[model samples]
Target chain A: TLAAPAIAQSAPELKWRLTSSFPKSLDTIFGAAEVFAKNVAEASDGKFQIQVFPAGEIVPGLQAADKVTDGTLEMAHTASYYYWGKDPTFAFATAVPFGLNSRQQNAWMYEGGGIDLMNEFYAAYNIHALPGGNTGAQMGGWFRKEIKTAADLKGVKMRIGGFGGKVIAKLGVVPQQIAGGDIYPALEKGTIDAAEWVGPYDDQKLGFNKVAPYYYYPGWWEGGPMLHFFINKAKWEGLPKNYQAIITGAAALANTDMQARYDHLNPGALKKLVADGAKLRPFSAEILEACFNAAKETYAEMNATNAAFKKVHDAVMAYRADAYLWQQVSEATFDNFMMAQQRKKAL
Target chain B: TLAAPAIAQSAPELKWRLTSSFPKSLDTIFGAAEVFAKNVAEASDGKFQIQVFPAGEIVPGLQAADKVTDGTLEMAHTASYYYWGKDPTFAFATAVPFGLNSRQQNAWMYEGGGIDLMNEFYAAYNIHALPGGNTGAQMGGWFRKEIKTAADLKGVKMRIGGFGGKVIAKLGVVPQQIAGGDIYPALEKGTIDAAEWVGPYDDQKLGFNKVAPYYYYPGWWEGGPMLHFFINKAKWEGLPKNYQAIITGAAALANTDMQARYDHLNPGALKKLVADGAKLRPFSAEILEACFNAAKETYAEMNATNAAFKKVHDAVMAYRADAYLWQQVSEATFDNFMMAQQRKKAL
Candidate 1:
């Protein structure tokens, strides 16, 4: 409240730089970061300007967690989970497989004490995190061959991204970590059998359907994968509180914009994939079951081994159980009958 | 563009009634409608007021279409697809399973001639449709038991709302059409074996998970279910053009608010559901395949039987194809890797 008087004295000018883990071509997610920058400048009456750079312009995409911690860049947008390499506990900042979807993920981060919890982890890294954007639940991977059994996953060379690779590797999968621009070529050259992308729209554009005929459903790994704008802790602390509020508010707007972009574009894209000889496939029960088990084992191991991962994982799993039960009575009944009738000849 | 100057003119005084398809307790969707009403009042210096009533207060939820059509109410917020029962062709006004998601839906409706095309159909019914809100691609419903094969669907009594019921019925589902308030009693009494509803948060509040043990994924029927505010066609036309613009702008604001509410509340609700012993299941391949085939047949039949269905369906389909392809390339690849990484322990 005291700052309000000071703020009224005069709006100050500020300048900053932002780097994104995505290219400008992947407009929705990348565009959120871009828009966040623009909002900063506009909302400040042109007093605040933020210049943005795509991944690799200044650092490797995966290295953003550290670069921001070191203040190499003023800010950056990347998945908090990407920093799992730095600390497994960082996954809490993004999402976990079979975890929360976009709505729940947002709640946890914003209101569910999740922000403070994750901040503890970030404190150690000398970085701060704000939710930049989220993709609602995603689809499984696009594969060259249909997975019929758990055995089918063994020895598979796939461009599986990030942490889910560790779980899948337990089933004998050889996980390949590649950037967005490189995935298609890898699949095309038979270097990888398949890859998982966001959903229909993005996948179709990359022409993954041509290279991988089989498309799967339910992006279990990312029920709601969240992206974050990371700031050096010292840099964040340096800003006038109003400017900080503006930045945080701008990130929320970008979050909304990012999801809006994907939702608007995904439906039509899925249809195109099917039309283009892309065979949509659900992962076989056996394979899914195996993956689920692997994920559980992985979770238990981490909980027992790492205190931070144990703390966050316990918190999230507790949250999920409570949420799932209440939906069965009201929401489920209404939706089931409605969906069941959707395809009917209107009475 | 020529109307830009006119739209900038001051909004005037008005009072109205808005009948909603949702309960007041379901704050998010209902809240959006309320926000629109409130914004109108404030913008017009308290000259405009809108009072919202839950469905069944003045009329049954499904009858909202007819009520607004006949000018029985000033306005109503529901889905155009809900009226597919009156005109099978109305399905195009909403989403079909695996159809356009939110982003594309907004684009088509606002920019791609979709609103014009939809109004052409709505004109016959004497209602003008405005974008009320959208629940970006929703989760599939929850079930009372695990379904491993298509056989489980035989004689399964379920609450499936909207046009989606038409396709699922082919799999031997005994679909029930009921209002939101009535679903719980029916499900609780064992009147239905399964149900589908909007995902997590709302579902949790509804307490569906208490009754249904098996929660399913991929609500194919409603990839991007959009709600519309229906005004009597004559009533709409009678408004000053500026008033009309205000309504549309306000409706857009409401749309965003509803989505934000859902995003914020869903996670903790889902956490609660799982803790209560609810089971999560994926609809078996056979059932999904069956539904897909039936949807195709339904489309074909409608095209052959009705000219309007054929016209709008053809146009939207073509648009969807192009949209899907573009997103697949850009959004999908980045998401896959990011999601997988989110699930891992730090490297």
Candidate 2:
């Protein structure tokens, strides 16, 4: 109780910088970091200020985790999966192929022991992790041509992200790693046949509809790709408990707000995409089944070779299995029935 | 810049109390208020302390909002829909029959204007609202017998909540308003043929499955029932901006954590119930269709007479329509396929 008196004393003003892996141009995704910083400043009465920088300003977007680890920056807002090369376990922090959706991801992280497990792994890298934002289940991609079967994937060069690319590679697709800026030209100029990005909101912004007419649903590879706010372990440890709580609270707000924005904004963008002649398509069951198998094989191979990957992968897989079971009986059934009824009315 | 020096001065200690509609036994639901209080106290270094009281501790559970409005309590952590007797508009701040699920509800409240509209309505009652918790989509209820058709509902006494009861009333069913503690006894004594509390987690704790063997799912009435933190407007306005921020952050954390806990815990709870011979069932298509129509009709009638109800209803309905459209193409399709695949593997 005596601590209350000391705590009421105004805390020291602190300033931090956050570098995001996303470009400022993609506001819905990158804007989440800004929202967190604003919340922190306001919550602390401007005492804890965090200045956010776009991808390349402080460090290259892909190098955000390293810089934070090295304490070059106090924090970084980026997708953990972006650092697949550092350790495959990083993918588990963000999204792996056939990973948890946004709701399920939150459940796994907050309640199903995922945050603790991931944090234990993160401790080795001198980082502390917090869920920052999420792009709800993304779209499959914009494809230059229709993909009807597993055979359709042969020789197709797709600009896909890390773990997902590895999965599809087994289907005879040539997985091409390319930066965001180069994806459109590659798709348009026939250098790549397909490209996967976030969802309707970000994809529409990138003008993917013009370059590729076949818009796909259910980015199965990323059921829900979560972004993280990585704090330098030493810096986080040094903060007063109040400041830590403020940071925790701000990150939680940003996490929920990002998804709300996407859910609200993507509908309008999808409407525009369809109106502009982009054909929306669902990946064939055959193709999806094949990809699922390949994802399993990819995981098995990695589990065999990488101890860290196996640890995180095992935890995520166990949590996801239970989540999927629960969702099937509740969310999945309700949605299926409701959507069917909705389509009937439309017809 | 000069304000920084003044803010550093110690703030006066403040203590508040929150009354919850739930009992302490139901940890996840009632526990959210406790979580919020703990976070606030910790973040404020014990300066701003909130003591949580369970329902009936200070006042009857249903009276939480009125008590907060009159400032008998500083706040109440309860579902806004509990005050449906005050005005049907109250349900929009919570959940309406056949309305948005958890994710969509968050989208509507945070992004599609539900929060602002609901808060405007709440202001008239001298309360300010913040989303505090959620129990994802609930089960329909525990039923002693099969409800295979709309006719099956006739003459059935069901212990249901506010707005949902009104919608289902058209099917010749007798809708009984009973407190959570009394539901099990009523079901056991045959006073009510069916009853709904929350999902598998809470229902199992209440021993509903023992009396009612048929456990129906997808509580259509409460697709995503959200709880609210109702602060006395005057009390809220008197707080420092920093204190308000702490409250906001704490409530957001509780809101997300409540659902995560339910989602994580429910799967295991459900498995245990089924193992104990509780039969899991889905409401039939014909019955669901009839209920949907009844719900729409009920809303229409309310809109015709209730101005406040009309305002919130209009906003929520508009947002939900857009959400449904987007979800069908994305969440619905993906979940349906994924669940089917999951079921196949299980088989």
Candidate 3:
């Protein structure tokens, strides 16, 4: 028989609890938490295990980060923007209106000093954050009526999440914050004129096409929203170095897997939604431009008031400028060409 | 002192070697192999150690896979397309002319049953493969002179890499497979009229711009190329399940890290290249169309002759058609809006 590795002899068993901000029904997002947990357990040979719980099981979805920070839980898998109400700086960890897309978000976090900057802010809350998942660029929303111009947004009550609502409010839109489950009812009963909830995969699950006829492209505010694994600072520091490495690797794996899942599933869900009479419309340039200016103004206000927000925001904006410049030259060009080929049935 | 865990007490010590297809000078690609090894070792508490070697340490760059296949090396890090001569089906594992982009490729691999399909094919070669790294959309090679149309490519000798050469050869261009280190001198002496490498970051390191002033936009042939970690089948099966899981997670981490590094670094390098007199040009639509048609012909021929190639190619093509249709809807629209803002200096 082969001799066992010496380091393995000293490994300690640990069990952790991870609270997810999403329900199990939203598998892509919630599934990432499960994926991370499974990877950690498998890699550790079941010596380290994480038990996951859906939102509201322990605390409300919006309170996940608070639980982690207060040590009520060892960790929480949630979007950082969900805590923007605590401090606007939290929004940068996930996304901001007109911010980086999925690829750019990963680049910024891993290479452009984003994780270090965000962690510096997160440390203040007694938490440490690692990117766990991303939704890629999202759909604008399902709307009962066409929104052709900035003026069309006036007085519209839309169930938009996080910092996006604040930006849109500048255009005279009424922004309502509602839970995912409540969104369909709100739109169906005419309580809300529009609601944005991820992209085709998740949106289709809520049967948004049944409630709203017109669907819009590009959720500009949450272009590439990232979900994070927030660990209690003390708990995170106490981990064995091996466990820390395993968790980090597992988190990164889950992060990539989530986006891949979204990318693969969205195409088919979109085809189904369209087949079910959901009308797809691009957010007109006029509307996008208007929102862009609104987002800029919102950022300016936060930058003046919040030092942490200012520090991270400035770095992201600088990187964003350069990222888009390079992206347009290669990635966008290739994508555009391929898209044209698809449209022409050349593929 | 507390008692050590049962699993740790029984862990076995193991050391392995990884040979990379990349030279150490190209850190981003070669660095991924180092990253994977480091993650694996750290996660295993140093019980499982994998020493890494750049190309030529254990075997030549292109022969890394063969060494693993014959059990001469425990594993190898290489691009699957580099082994296309062994089997055309191998190209689907890395990339093909006018194939999927980075995000799309990840989607196909992780969520679209791509790994299972490729592994089935690799089983014949006595290997088990995992995605290790990706070079997003690559830049079209540096050129001594501009190539405006397909007509300009006639009789041109280009130092193009694997599989892409076969597709472009249909257009009367002679494709030369020169090693990366030799491409510069070959281009300088006019031994090759043009040579394509990776994007701005790697290309800048090689000083391609100094010899070839005309830098091209998209390398349609090698868009979103993936590199693989090829483990000897017998060695992989002999590992404990814990090590297998750890290796899988580490590879995924390195895979995401490589692309993030490229995306973050490319922008600055591109700026430097342009400032240092690299004239950037887009391949003309006429040329792109011609190349796309040629790629289609090449794929079709392979599909008809090779059953393994047909199985994977058909699935990829089916997914590609849908991926683009959905991408154009949300991702492209959002990107176009941002790029336009960047151009107008409104961002």
Between candidates 1 and 3, name the one with more favorable lDDT.
Answer: 3
How far in Å is the alpha carbon of A15 misplaced in model 2?
0.9
TM-score of 2: 0.97
Best candidate (score: lDDT): 3
lDDT by residue (tens digit), candidate 2, B179-287: 7778888999998999988888888888888899998877888888899999999999998887888888888888888988998899899889899889988888888
TM-score of 1: 0.59
Q: Which lDDT value does model 2 have at B166?
A: 87
lDDT at position A181, candidate 3: 82
Per residue, candidate 1 scores C-alpha lDDT tens digits across B22-125 of 77877777777787777555433344577888878988777888888788898998878877877777877778865776656766776577888999888998
Number of colliding residue pairs in each model: 91, 0, 9
Candidate 2 wrongly placed segments (more than 4 Å): A1-10, A345-347, B1-5, B8-10
Our model 1 lands, by Cα RMSD against the true structure, at 9.2
Worst 10 residues of 1 chain A by lDDT: A326-335
lDDT of 1 by residue, A96-136 (tens): 76676665576567656677888887998888888877776
True contacts kept of each: 0.08, 0.56, 0.84
Q: Evaluate residue A138 in candidate 3 and report its C-alpha lDDT on the 0 to 100 scale.
A: 94
Error of 1 at A300 (Å): 0.5
Docking class of 3: high
